[model samples]
Target: MHNSSQPRTDAPSAASEPVIEVRGLAKEYRVFDKPEGLMASVTGLFNRKSRVVEALRGVDLRVEKGEFVAMLGPNGAGKTTFLKLLSGIITPTRGSATVLGSVPWERTDDFRRRFALVMGQRNQLWWDLPAAESFRLHKEIYRIDTPRFERTRDELVDLLDVRKLLLRPVRDLSLGERMKLELVAALLHEPEVLFLDEPTIGLDVVAQHALHRFLAHVQAERQMTVILTTHYMKDVAALCKRLVVVTQGSILYDGSLEQIVDRFTSHKIVTLDLDAPPDRAAIDRLGFPCEIRGPQVILRIDRTRIADVLPGILRGQGVRDVSVEDVPLEEIVAEMFRSGSTAGTDGATGAPR
Candidate 1:
C-alpha cells in the first residue's frame, strides 16, 4: 500500500480507458519431479526432471469501472493464479495485462495503491496485535493523510460495527470478526480496484450476509471496480451481475448471471410442495425428470414441456405451494463445464432447449 498526491504519472493509458485489460495472459509453473532412488537423487543435481503446469492459458478479458464481476471455477482451475497475476504477486509466463493502465507486474507505488486484494485463506492483520495497530500501519504504509485516515477508519469500523474490536487483538477475535477487520484493513486505502478471492469461505450464513451487505454498500457508494473469484452462489447472486466461468485454465463462459442459465441449461425447475405426501407412482407415470423430497416434487422440465407438464403435475397432486425458477446458476455452471460449448463473451450459444 503506497499513495501519492499525484498517482499513475507513468500510466500507459488514460482514466477513461478500461480499468483492467488482459490480452493472452498466461502463467505456467515449472514443477520439479522428485525420485526416490539414491542414484537418481545423486544425478538430480546434474539433471533434474520437471514438468510445466499451465495455470492460466491465453485468457483475454476486460473490466470496466464500477462493475462487479464474479470469476467462477473449480479447484485447480487457475482462479487463484489469475488473481495473483493481476495483483502482481507473480509474473505471467506469457502475454500481458494492464491494470489501471499500468502493467501489474511492474509493482509501482502508484499501481499498488490503486488496487486491494482480499484472500480468505490469508490474514493481513498482525495476529497478536490489536487490529487498530494494523490499521495504523496501513495508514502509514499508504501515507494516508491523518484526518482522512481517521475519517476513513471510523467510517469502516462503524460500517462493520466493530469499533470496540479495533483495540482488541486480532487473534482474540472470532473468525467472522477477523474477517471484518481484514475488510476494513484492505479498504482503508480506498483502492479503485478490489479483488476478492473467496472472501466468504468459512463464514456462517449470518456473517456472510453481513459481509455481503457491506461489500454491496462499498461498491455502490464508491463505484469501485471489483473482480471476485468465489464458489458461493449466494455471493454471486447478491453481488455480481456478470460472470466469467473457467475450467482447466480456460475461460468457458463470460456473460450475465441470467444468460448463464439460458445458455447452459435446457430445462427449468418447478417445485411443487404438496399438502400431503403424494404417491410416487403418480409422478413416475408422468415419465418426466422429477425428484421427490418429502412432500415436494421437483421437476426438471424442458422449456417446451412447461405449459403441458405443469397442468399434469398439478392435476392430481395435493399442491399446497408451487414455485418456478430458472435452473439454479450453480447447476447451469456445472453443466457448462461438463459440456464445453458456447458461453463466451460474445454470447456463445449452447444447445437449444
Candidate 2:
C-alpha cells in the first residue's frame, strides 16, 4: 500500500512521457446471428451466421499523469470497451496501448498492483458479507501492511462519512451508501490509476455531488490519473477538464469542454427582457430563430453577427435586460452525437482547423 503520509517517490520522473498512451487501438466482436422462428433456428443450427461489430476504431490518444479525462458517448459508442482495454479487463483486437509504462493486456503483478477498475453496475464485494469483511479481504489480497491498511481505510471512511455503514451487509446498504463503500474498497490499496465506468449511474443528484467532491479531493491529494466513462453530463462538467466524445466506434471530439462548444456551435443564445411585448414584424427582421415568452424574447444569433444584430434589437424596444451566453455543453454534445462528423477537426487534437 502507498504511504499516505509521504510523497510518492516512485512516480515517473520524465514529465514529457504520458502515463497512458495508445495508437491505432481497436476492438471487434464477432457476434453470431440467431434465427427467430423455430424452423429457421433448426436449419440455422447446421450453419451459423456471424458478423463482425467494430466496438472501437483505430483511435490514438495520450494522457499524462494526474489528468482526469472523461469519455462521453451514446449507447454502443465503445466508451466502456476502451476503459476495459486500458484496465486489462479485456484484450484489444488490434493495435496497442500502455498504461503506467506496461502493456495493460500483459496484466503483470506490478501493473495490477498499481491500478483499480470500478464499474458502477458491478459489485466487487460479497453480497452476503459486511463491507468491513470485504475491506479485510482486499487488505489481504493487496498484501497491504497493517498500519497502512488501517490508516487508509479509516481516512477514507472518515472522508466519505461512511464509517457507520461499514458493518452493514453489502446487500443491505442503499445504492449511494454501497457506492461509497465500493470507492473505499477500490482506494484501500492506493492505486496510481483509477478507471471509473459510470460510477455515478443511478445516483441521486446529492449522491453525485458528494462523490464528485470526494474524487476531486482524493485525486488532488494523490495525483492519481483517472479515466471516467459516464453519460451524466453533470459528471463530465464537474470532474473532468478534458473531454473525449466517441461515437460509432470512433472518437468524434477530443478537447476541453470550451473547445468542443466553440468548434461545434456557431450561435449564441441571446435573451432579452422587454418592457412591452415586441412587434412580430420587427422580430422577424432580426433574421434569427426567435421565441417570445411573455415580455422576454429569446434568440439564437450567429456569433459573428452578434455585434451588428444585438445593437439593433436593444435599441428597437423597451429592453429591460439583455444577456448573451454560449450554447449549453449538453446541447453541443447531443448535436455531435447526431451528426458524428469529424470534418474540419484536427486529427491530433480534435480542434477546428
* Candidate 1 ranges with C-alpha deviation above 4 Å: 1-16, 35-47, 274-281, 340-353
TM-score of model number 1: 0.87
Query: Model 1 over residues 24-82: C-alpha lDDT tens digits?
Result: 88889999998889999999988999999978777777788888988887778789999
**All candidates' lDDT scores?**
0.83, 0.85
> lDDT of candidate 1 vs native?
0.83
Given candidate 1, what's the lDDT at residue 38? 93
The clash numbers for all candidates, in the given order, read 0, 0
Q: Which regions of candidate 2 are displaced past 4 Å? A: 1-15, 341-353
Q: How far is candidate 1 from the true structure (C-alpha RMSD, Å)?
A: 6.9
- Predicted structure with the largest TM-score when compared to the true one: 2
The stretch of ten residues in a row with the least summed lDDT in candidate 1 is 1-10
